[model samples]
Target: MTTTRPVLYLFGSAAPPVFDVAAVVADAQGRGFEVCLGLTSTAARWLEPRKAGLERLTGHPVRSAYKMPGEPDVWPKADVIAVAPATFNTVNAWALGITREFVVGVVAEGIGKGIPMVAMPCVNAAYAQHRQFERSIADLRGMGVRVLYGDGGFVPNLPGRGKPEEYPWHLLLGAVEEIRGAQGEGRSS
Candidate 1:
């Protein structure tokens, strides 16, 4: 509400889809979001080659770490977040509110800030079956973080074999819109 365009925090994990972030950024912008990118440490390297291009697309530094205590924040406050290809590790850590990494820190804090958020997990079926993964999904859903997983959302691939065609990157932007619209209309997200 403070700005004409929503400030979107587009967070990427270490999934193979992280390499295709340029398309995601373009899509979010097309949907009227002013995107900012944040990568999990593992994802930071995967995107290093595209960092400058990403910065140019987003008009903000692609941050992968916490700034020094005295350093000023560079990114604008987020209106919503879309974490496509969220990994199993980040999902569970975020559910536990662990701030071990920069992406986790921002997302954990986003939950507290009551910002609308949507996440699309990119885990294999074996990883998705873990008891903790189920619990984490429930916990996040309870806190109103939309987890785009299972059934109509993301379907798990075979262990050690994720096909790029099946990552479901296109679903995330729509999920964000649905959740944000629901929230905007005072409906449950």
Candidate 2:
């Protein structure tokens, strides 16, 4: 029997790349993931104008709120969760286990469920230097979450100076692919 593509929960925070997330979504699907989108309320607005296109791409509703009572959840169970273009606020809130928004809620629950996750930050260099951001990265990494940053991952861009091409959208997908490969190998071994 043919297996279904693995579901990947693609979360986006309010950042520049969130405006052009379709490219990232296209990349993830190319690497064999079945993508589902969840955005921070703020980020959701950025995509709202093109919501129909995004929905068609993912075959799922882009969720940003709690589902109505007794409404069946439409999102698929994730084999992995990737948060791309994560902002400083989202990083800190997630590390502190705050679930005030749908994106953060998925993160908290994903960690609890032992689902592999990867995050790619899009903070400015100044914001990246914040004590909270540093601590959040450490705390998340300590929990086995792949916080993709630094040399091989996302490097903070200079304030108001970086181009959209500089965001390491692929690193987030690569991290997820690596984790999935590792998990598959584990099962076979």
Candidate 3:
């Protein structure tokens, strides 16, 4: 099917990404994409739903997995799935095809249907450097997922780590662009 308006599924982990998510949402809206966001239970603590007024902004309701009752079977037929600030837990789950959570279930279904998945991981140096985490990324890639390279080896907002030139909007959207490109090439999930 020819999709005029690309559907984007935005997922944030319990620990929000270092970059701002509100800006990401605005950018996606400006780009003419339909946005639906899923916030991990843990992520909501760091992220304020009121800050973005996410439901109003995305034109779709926003809720955490626990708060949301039943599976969201009729998602917007996403052209791309962007999981930025993907926590170690979320990334691992996606890599393993585990659908225990809301975001995991959406991504699992998306990948199974040939949608491209983009994961932008944010974690402490220790976790990022762990062998298990590394293997999980490998497994995701093996499953045709794209793991975008972020500020590796540097902790966000920490002194001496320096800051990335592009803020949350760019980094997350850039990953989406990569997924869009892969999709145009008929890449599988």
Candidate 4:
């Protein structure tokens, strides 16, 4: 059966904050989104113990790999996509169009499909200092992604001193709501 609720494809990478995805999913649901959880391969393994519970929460199977050709899609089509706690590798790979990971592949393709997408990176201060990180952020912005980084979004913490608990998941959820609203306006106009 199809759902009337706006569907959100919430993707997470292998970062410390990813462990808190259950709460994030609940929060997204509270905000009226029908969320589908997707993870990078490593993040899937990291949360393997909680996989079944996550499925129960979202009412959909958690996906980490592309389905075999001809396999039917289990989740509803996404109205918006949000990548929270995106890792250093995920950011670079997405900006470079590398689709080895399912999460990156969807977001990369989402650009061409005109799906509103947002991403917030979770990286240590040292990794943030890498020149490529800044360029990737810029590239993603150029491609129309609302990357929640720096100032108002995720600010990297010092290596070995990171606080995953402080990651601003609310910002991503708020952005999704805002994007959905804008899409509605555009459709009416």
For each of the candidates, the C-alpha root-mean-square deviation to the true structure, in angstroms, is 2.5, 1.9, 4.4, 0.8
The C-alpha stretches of model 4 lying farther than 4 A from their native spots are: none
lDDT for model 1 comes to 0.88
Model 4 clash number: 0
C-alpha lDDT (0 to 100) for residue 27 of candidate 3: 88
List residue ranges in candidate 1 displaced over 4 A: 186-189
* Clash count of each predicted structure: 0, 0, 2, 0
> Candidate 1 vs candidate 4: which has greater TM-score?
4
Which candidate number maximizes lDDT? 4
Off by over 4 Å in 2: 1-3
Per-residue lDDT of model 4, residues 134-167, tens digit only: 9999999999999999888998889999988888
Instruction: Report, for every candidate in turn, its global Cα lDDT versus the true structure.
Output: 0.88, 0.87, 0.70, 0.95
- What digit string (tens of lDDT, one per residue) describes model 3 on residues 88-169? 8988888777777878887777777888777777666667766878888888878877777545322434433433333244
> Could you tell me how far off, in angstroms, the CA of residue 39 lies in candidate 1 after the best superposition?
0.2
Measured on C-alpha atoms, candidate 4 has an lDDT of: 0.95
Estimated TM-score per prediction? 0.93, 0.95, 0.77, 0.98
Best by TM-score: 4
Per-residue lDDT of 25 in model 1 = 92
Residue range 1-189, candidate 2, lDDT tens digits = 122998889999989888878988998899999999999999988888988999999888988887878988787688889998888999999999988988998898888899999998888999987898999999999987898889898888789977777677777888889988988898998
